[model samples]
Target: MDIIGFLKSQFLCHLFISYVFIGTGLIINLIQLFTLPLWPLNKQLYRKINCRLAYCVSSQLVMLLEWWSGTDCTLYTDLTNYSKYGKENAIVILNHNFEIDFLCGWNFCERFGLLGSSKVLAKKELSYVPVIGWMWYFLEIVFCKRKWEEDRKTVVQGLQNLRDYPEHFWFLIHCEGTRFTEKKHEISMQVAEAKGLPKLKYHLLPRTKGFAVTVQSLRNVSKKFYTEGRRSMSAVYDSTLNFRNNENPTLLGVLNGKKYHADLYVRRIPLEEIPEDDQECAQWLHKLYQEKDSFQEEYYKTGTYPGTAIVPARRPWTLLNWLFWASLLSYPLCKGLANMISSGSYLTLTVFALLMVIVSVGVRRMIGVTEIDRGSTYGNNENKKKQP
Candidate 1:
């Protein structure tokens, strides 16, 4: 193995990378706080600054996925429609089946120049995560508790906050709400049977409340304040993702330098086609998911999406950004370790070791997001539990 490849596989190296990511992320979080005042004065300028700051931290993981792991993300679409990506605002509905699916989503965001400003409908618990979650707070990422009563207001407010956002971004909504599993699928199928809907072979019954609320709320933005001669939500990007070689990519796999092939098929649907009423919108979302299920089945059976032939070129910016962070952080870290060792103080070494242990535990907890067995049972019942 090459030197970097060896480092990618080591837990100690992951710990060091996590240290730099979290440490620098915290500093950026503080800077984000200071920018709060700038928002009222110059909203666009404040947003632009935060977008770049968010890029600094987000690109680190993008590097791990693209550069370190060398994962290939193929975009399947036509040239005419594919050109619209990253050029305008859109709502992205995606399947939550793989642990690193969100990472793949981020990879696409990076390739299309939207990594710095992309948003998601993340669970409320993720807001407490060290680096990524903390950064999301400043980005105003929409967080839901999954309870219709509570999340309704939060989702509306969050989407409303983005109405005047300066940069173009792709807002991701994992309508399934949680990762897929057999038990969840069985439960969702029961719900489908109860509702007289078609059985889904590969996906869970989507939590319609989130999608309904998001579409309804963003619809208001479109009607009220259009930007750049277009509605705030100009299009909906229905993205279906699958892994090649039946590989289930995980955060640990990426840390260990496991290369996986990701094929994402995105279809652009106009926003006006979405139903405006809550009930009608909920039905529309359900239908969209059913179509997504068919796509997944087709992918498994034929290993390709229907009529999708476009795969965008991956960019080197993510790798360059990662190397910048590594170069900037590695020297100080090595110097600190050397000083601690030369001091001959057993206490310093002990404290350092203890900190490593704590951070390692934290990283494991972070990795829990990508573990299928460790996933929550949100959609396993006829009535979905509110995501915590």
Candidate 2:
């Protein structure tokens, strides 16, 4: 492993990186707040400025994943229609299986020149995550509480706001609502059985209200890109990272936040074909997840997935972005923080520390939930004796 990669693997290195990102993010957010007065006078200009600011912040992490860590991302897709990617607005349906899946999605966005504008229908909790969540707010990214009744109206309204966006965009949606887990999978399979639907070995039950509402809202305004559906979307699927030695591999790599061998299968489905009724849409989504499960099973056994040719991830813009942010914001932000600390503002320091503590606790809780123990420990001898 290289020196940068080695540093990334250490706990101290992760802590340092986290603190720097958090601190830098806090400063950027403060800068954003100062721009609030300008919004009422120039809404469009404010949005455009916000997008540029966000690009500066997020591109750092993307650079860390791509360049510093030397992670390889290969996309599988047909070249015939690749030119149509960012020319039109579309809804992107993706599987929520990995921690850094969003980052990979962003990487694709970067490649297609849509990094600044790509959005997602994320859970409400993510909106509080420092740089990423704050940036999403200005990008018009939709956040859902995940309750169908409560989320339906708000999500649709959010999607509607994107109709007149100045630039082309891709709205990503993880229909599963949360990341995949074995226990969740089992429960979802039970729900499927009760509903008389086929069981899925790879994914959990998809909460279709979000997808249904999104389709309804954007059907007239934009096109649709179903990553795992029939016809190909102009995007490509990059080869992700996977660890073979660990019993349960930590998703985070040294330089890369987390390693995932992502094989995205993108297809462009027309907006009109998406079911109209909620119940029908939900049923269709359930069947789709079942098919995704079968594909995953085939992949695990055969070590390959059915898809088109691979495309290399060559995002030079990511490097340029990192350099720009570090040059423009790094020194000024550091000086500002130093001055504040030296001024002896007790209350401000207390508030900052408290917020950091809360964010740390929340991140820990999320990681814990995603890492629930699922393996069995008892030997089969006892079971065999009891059966006899």
Candidate with top lDDT is 1
- CA displacement after TM-score superposition, residue 26 of candidate 2 (Å): 2.1
Residue 245 Cα positional deviation in candidate 1, in Å, after optimal superposition: 1.5
Query: How many angstroms is residue 157 displaced in model 2 relative to the true structure, after the best TM-score fit?
Result: 1.4
Any residue pairs clashing in model 1, and if so which?
none
lDDT of 2 at 81: 46
At residue 364, what lDDT does model 2 achieve?
53
Write model 1 residue lDDT over 230-313, tens digit each, in one string: 347778899999998898788998989989999999889988899888788888888888899889888989899876566677
lDDT of each: 0.83, 0.63
The CA lDDT at 344 in model 2 is: 75
Candidate 2 global Cα RMSD: 7.9
Residues 305-376 of candidate 2: C-alpha lDDT, one tens digit per residue: 565746555768878865655565558556756866887798767866675576566445534544434222
